[model samples]
Target: MEEESMEEEGGGGCEAMMDDQNHNNWGAGGYGRHLLGPAAAPLGNSLLRGPAAGPTADPELSDVPEANGVLRGCEPGKGGAGAIAAAININASTSKFLMNVITIEDYKSTYWPKLDSAIDQLLTQSPGDYIPISYEQIYSCVYKCVCQQHSEQMYSDLIKKITNHLERVSKELQASPPDLYIERFNVALGQYMGALQSIVPLFIYMNKFYIETKLNRDLKDDLIKLFTEHVAEKHIYNLMPLLLEAQSTPFQITPSTMANIVKGLYTLRPEWVQMAPALFSKFIPNILPPAVESELQEYAAQDQKLQRELMQNGFDRGDQSRKRAGEELTYNGSSACASSRGYR
Candidate 1:
């Protein structure tokens, strides 16, 4: 957690807002099995990953952000047995962790119009080809909001608007082709999360001090809630099977962690269970064991292929044997962009 030192200007600095799910060692929510357990997944039940940020009272004047931070997510291939289910994205977003002390009236009149336009670009633009907008400016705007005396309302409204936009994006995702839903989700989720992560730090000072402490919520939690509710769960319902297969790769995960995976599943979206009790009561338990077994067989086949390559290379050899295996077999894991903890 980054601490804020108060100054006259009261524009403040921020730290990276870490992900709710990343390198979680609770051993409670593995990538595969626990979804069959029950509702109320323990995942992210604790909102503050590390230390809470500075008090929400008032901020210092604006300066450059402290650093860049990654939005934690499962990359295509990363982690151990339970590592199969990757996070949203490991891409870094500038934590424009800052504050500006300006009145809400100024925020509404002077800054918001421009900020709103930048948000429009964020929503309308395509992946990697975003309309150029200064993230620094957005930080400046939100920072100013935090400095005002009546910032709680400001923050709430900001979250409401942001949520509305995300809901729009979610509705758009639903229009995509059924086969292309995951691909579309990957693209949309990446872009939206990146945008949200970048600007979130602007609200961090207030979130740490006032919002989380007083309102019992923070900017990170609200953004994640919007995604989990509006976007992630719908697609995850379809993608769960594939995620289980991916996590079970190499067969390194134990049943303990596999149970954690089930926990992770229950957390994805609980509303699904309420709407259709059978999804969990009927389908999950019956299917998951077989799924795990099937993934084990796949891992075994890969292991055998590795064994054959070793034999072909005169086993018990040096790096050359390993190189040969890399060339011959798909291998246990692929390259992943990951962060162990914190923003970097």
Candidate 2:
């Protein structure tokens, strides 16, 4: 009975050992099966296929040192590392191609053609007739071109050309028939005067030397006339007191010279009539014959009355039309004055 019990215990121990071994083997086999579903199958097949047999073995499975080196390099972790590296290389190549495409699109759409066309157009139009060109047209073109080209030197040259053309045209117009030339001359004169008023103050403040040296006396006189014609009489009255003060000095102002200056200012500042009633009254008597003064007053009254009637009647006319009419009459009157002076 003792021997049988010992044998029975030995048998139980052997059975337990076998059961543990079988369990471990079964777990390992289950793990291998899971891996083989997708991951291990391909590697297993490659190993079974073996590398290559001879020199003329499949090119797809050649056995050269390089090939063996590649296989060894691609083994397990190293082989998987090669596949990852290949994927990274392909992504990098694709990213570079996309960047190149974006750069090309930007160049074609915005920068390249615009620059080329502007350069070509500027070259073509550089030498055309600039004198007959209207100020509005020239200024518009110049502004457009400068903004596009961003060329300071080119802008300066264009401005200089326009100014020089204006000067030459003004000189020519002065010698032509006064009746025919007056309207065009006035237009050009108005443009130059506006520019002078706006630009000259800045130039004087910043670079007085340029004005004194470069802006000629003729241009100065022309600008003065333009401004004087538009000044109000209130300004003239204010100016008169100052002029009287200046004249009261030891070197007295002559009546004739004062009259001429006052006449020019009167054309500019009609509002001066309200300010210096006594002075204007005294001056008018001394300057003109009584009959002529009476006639002038009558004519002025008639003009005002007519203008009021036109406005009240709803005539669609502007100040410019009125100014042009006055200018035409002045031209005619000046011709008569010249004729009378010739007789004298």
Candidate 3:
């Protein structure tokens, strides 16, 4: 009996050792059924039969804890909540920024006429005050207003009037060389340049229009000549080199900048195109590269072929239309003659 008890104890020690070894190996290599073999089943069964097998009991109910202290002072009858709510309501109302809304109808009926009258008043002011106003200031204000208002017609008319005014004022300043007014004149010129910048797109649009319209050659020639004269007189030749250099650089010229140049050129009127080759050669040599020059010469030669084709097409269409009209007229005349012969 003593031997049997000792063997049973030895067997239990062996199983514990095996369980420990399996647990260590499982930790090292991760848990797997193959690692435990038959050891895990006995250990799991023994734990199931222990005190942990009993069902858990429900927790006892308890009362809520009292407050540490009461409010320092309390009103007997008046509600404090009403005053607190009123304070919140007042805060909410005061938090918003004030905004003014003007409807489109109100703008047209009330604001626009008033605005126009104000502008006219400023424009027609006495020469003393008007002359003192730099061309730059007038132009800047006009452009800003035009942009804000989205008034294309107003913008165009204002620009034309301002250009004419600047021209007239520039001449007047030149005639009556004011000692104190030199700075003012320079400022005015700067402002005029700003105005020109604003109207540049319009100039480009007009130039394309004229080109497409195929205005008379004589009128085109005259306009080119006028432009040339203006460029020479204005010392725009000096400015052109800088503009060319700017063009060659990586920085792109804005539409406004291009418009200014185009409009400036346009204002010089017709004579400028004739002088373009020489002017460009002197100022913007990069534009007339050797390859481009060669291409232009080639294009000139091809121009004759293009012109001939155009002329032939026009002649064919005109001749066919004229012949058809003539035949109709002749047939009508013969019919009248036959009627007269019958009457006789």
Candidate 4:
């Protein structure tokens, strides 16, 4: 690569100094204390720890490494001893210090492509025929990246790429004609679930450990967010009229084989449920008979004793009248919040 070619960077900022701030003890420590001059350092951005950071990876370097795994910085012939520094500040005394510098370019062209392909295989290949031969290799590469102290950035990038892929899928799902929108979207969700089930095994470490412990999120939940936003929310919004129809198959399959898309939404956390209070409201009228609704509406406007009587006679509509009487209607999946709820 050309000089000043290091163009991107990744990794979190962590500063825990061990007495030796500027001390370069290369000889005393097994790995030489090699702090290159600022002019020639390429991977220096990641290694240098500063004050704080937000929820993203570090900024990109100006001269990132090339795809062939070639390290091009201050060459020995060009910058003399300074060139040999490349981009690392080695100072380890106890264990065998092996400074493996991985530039963002290498991650993009090398590691990410292989991982992306593996994911493609997982999501596309038939589950019966899916083979995760590269699970070990991929895990090891990620393990190396973590050991090299680049886990945060790698984790962040993985989240982004997965979200992007899910977005593409959601768009395709949305393109379905109105007549078949929910039906086709259900099929897509089934496909996505099958793909997730078939492939998640390969990345057990990433799902269980890296995602939860390091990233502070459950793997299953994080992935489900993609569908929740793209498929669930959109389907409810775009296909509300159809979904609310009494003959709508998606709503009719409630107690048994719920539409996979809706079931998928049910599997999400309470926050998602809270955000969609009105989502369940649309189907309320469809579920209950008009007579039952009228009886409940009467109780809703009457005394507590009469309301209790209506409730005991199986006409117990929780707040349905208030809901119908221009109240701040909501659906919180509770018998008390509203009997028509509990769709979960």
Q: Model 2 compared with the native: what TM-score?
A: 0.20
All candidates: TM-score = 0.43, 0.20, 0.22, 0.47
Tens digits of per-residue lDDT, candidate 4, 1-344, equal 11122222223211111113322333222123232233223333333332224311233333444323333442222322233334333324212233234466666666667677777766655436746555667655664444334556666776677677778877886777776776666666777777777445645545544566656887666667766776567666565465555233323434232344444555643344444444543333232234565476565564566556556657656554445433343433453466445335
Best by TM-score: 4
Arrange candidates, best TM-score first.
4, 1, 3, 2
The local distance difference test score of model 4 is: 0.49
Q: In angstroms, how far off is 277's CA in candidate 2?
A: 15
For candidate 2, lDDT tens digit of each residue in 1-344?
00111111212322222333442332213322232233333433344344433231223322212321222222232233234233222234333323322133343354334433433233223223233323333333223222223223332433444445455655555565533432333344444444454333322311222223334333344445534543322134444565565344312444554555555444445556455544454455443334464487787786677667657657545555433222333426767565555432
Q: Which stretches of candidate 1 lie over 4 Å from their true place?
A: 1-105, 123-131, 241-344
Q: Which sections of candidate 3 miss by over 4 Å?
A: 1-160, 173-190, 196-273, 276-279, 286-344
Residue ranges of candidate 4 with Cα displaced over 4 Å: 1-103, 125-133, 198-214, 246-259, 269-344
Supply the TM-score for candidate 1: 0.43
Instruction: Compute the lDDT for candidate 2.
Output: 0.38
Instruction: Give the distance in Å from residue 97's predicted Cα in candidate 3 to where it truly belongs.
Output: 21
Error of 2 at 20 (Å): 99
CA lDDT scores, all candidates in order: 0.48, 0.38, 0.36, 0.49
Positional deviation of 218 in candidate 2, in angstroms?
15
